[model samples]
Target: MIERLPARAFAAGVVTLALVSGVVSYLMVQPDPAVDTTRVTAAPAEVAASASAPSLVTAAGLEQFRRDYRDRFGDTLLDEATLHDEYASIERAVPHSPDRVMPYSYRGTFESDHSPTTRPVGTPEFDLDALDVPLLARYLAGAPQSVGVPDGSVSHVGLGIDVGEATVSIYVSNRAQENGYLVLTPDGRVLAVRRFEP
Candidate 1:
């Protein structure tokens, strides 16, 4: 009995430690401020149907985004007027989500409309005046080193935002075909875009 009591006490201590650790880890993971809570509502008393992404970005909206994305950005780098128009289109179509964004990918392919891919793998850290998208903008504005481009490349072309049935897509291209992926809020702030090859 004495031996069993010791074992039981040790097990209880381990269990308590594990529970506390899990809670601490969860709390430490700061909640993203871009998650949309506006869609949350009490289920109507009449019908029973609730199964979809909390935020419903429409097909038409995505289409508009695609259209806006048509013009390649990096070529001349969108002039202020063009950027304003692009922003206006986005503003009209997609209302900003009140919730925090949890990092989304603005993925697409970039070919012509841009310089040849020269940077093979590693290019020394430097700044590029890429596109006007939040991610690219943030890059040029703050973290230029965190960008993907071929050697000698200075900017990326901006393709409009495209929303597929499942994904919202924003395409940009530079010397590096796959320049980077962006984490954007509905309000159009680029949380971050990490440049990589692949």
Candidate 2:
């Protein structure tokens, strides 16, 4: 004799079969584990040497040097009244010295409205005496010749001095509003003492 299955029973059996098949398929598929470690390496000896080297100038040393600079050349560069005036007018008028051409030993370039565009990148050393500015020539004569770094912008109190033949630039965050000067020297003597600002 033929037997007939109930509709509800037939549906329940089909659902159970599907659930079992899904569980078996998932268990059979497993992920593989691998990592790429190419960038990891031991440190170099030069890096270790650089990390251990001592600095040439310390913060205290720099302050002492600045104080010495003031004491030695302060009078020739600027008096108290002039310094105050320069500070007061620093925001308005900043004097730009003539383009100075020196040997490419120490070279730096900065952007300024006054900077000359046609100036050679690596100009040979020219005689400072040939320049019309006497103070600049004198400063170059007295100071040890070195290269000037590019000073980006003129701050409230910017200082430029000749270190050897190269110009060293300094910026003062707090300038007295009475008077000031831009002094350049070769052998530690004041070169050009121009009233930088008002």
Candidate 3:
């Protein structure tokens, strides 16, 4: 009976320790009520939805954005005039070495037309004319199936001009998540394909 008593006492001690530890752990992980989380509490999905991404990657798209801006606030640079995504800028070749033409948002002056954004520049230019639009259309249509993302889930399409090559970045759902970009050349050549599973 004495031995059983000791065992019971030991079991009770263990149970008490466990309950205390669990309570401490739970309290440690809980968010502080005093902290303001209003600005930082956006869910992944909500953040994705709220993120500003340009719909088009061409010069025409740039024109559209400018037109929209003009329609809303005439001739004045507003807070929304900023290009949230740097990838939205298209690289165009200029005559001078230190002067490159790009959109106003991408380090360029606020101009309705593509204007020179001064930078140490290069020879080969992003050939917008050489882009195989028909081929790109077909590939983007099949990108969901080919890249293993949800069907018809193309969320954003942006352009990036790197090393004088025109590359397109396509986001399936949320670009900020584990899912990455489907990078392709303007000629419809696949550069990199990344997909999100969860």
Position 150, candidate 3: lDDT: 47
| Per-residue lDDT of 191 in model 1 | 32
Residue 50 local lDDT, model 1: 26
Superposed on all Cα atoms, the candidates' RMSDs to the truth, in angstroms, are 23.0, 34.7, 23.1
Query: Native-vs-model 1 lDDT?
Result: 0.24
Candidate 3 has its poorest 10 consecutive residues by lDDT at 1-10
Error at 135, model 3, angstroms: 0.9
Question: For model 3, how big is the CA root-mean-square deviation?
Answer: 23.1
Per-residue lDDT of model 2, residues 1-198, tens digit only: 111111110000001111233322100111122321111111111111222221112122222323433453342221111011111110111113223321111001112334222323333221212222322222222121111112211232222212224222212212333332223222222223222232
What TM-score quantifies how close candidate 2 is to the native fold? 0.19
Q: Please give the TM-score that candidate 1 achieves against the real structure.
A: 0.22
Candidate 3 backbone overlaps, count: 0
Off by over 4 Å in 3: 1-102, 105-117, 174-178
Tell me how candidate 3 scores on lDDT.
Answer: 0.38
Best by TM-score: 3
**What's the alpha carbon RMSD for model 2?**
34.7
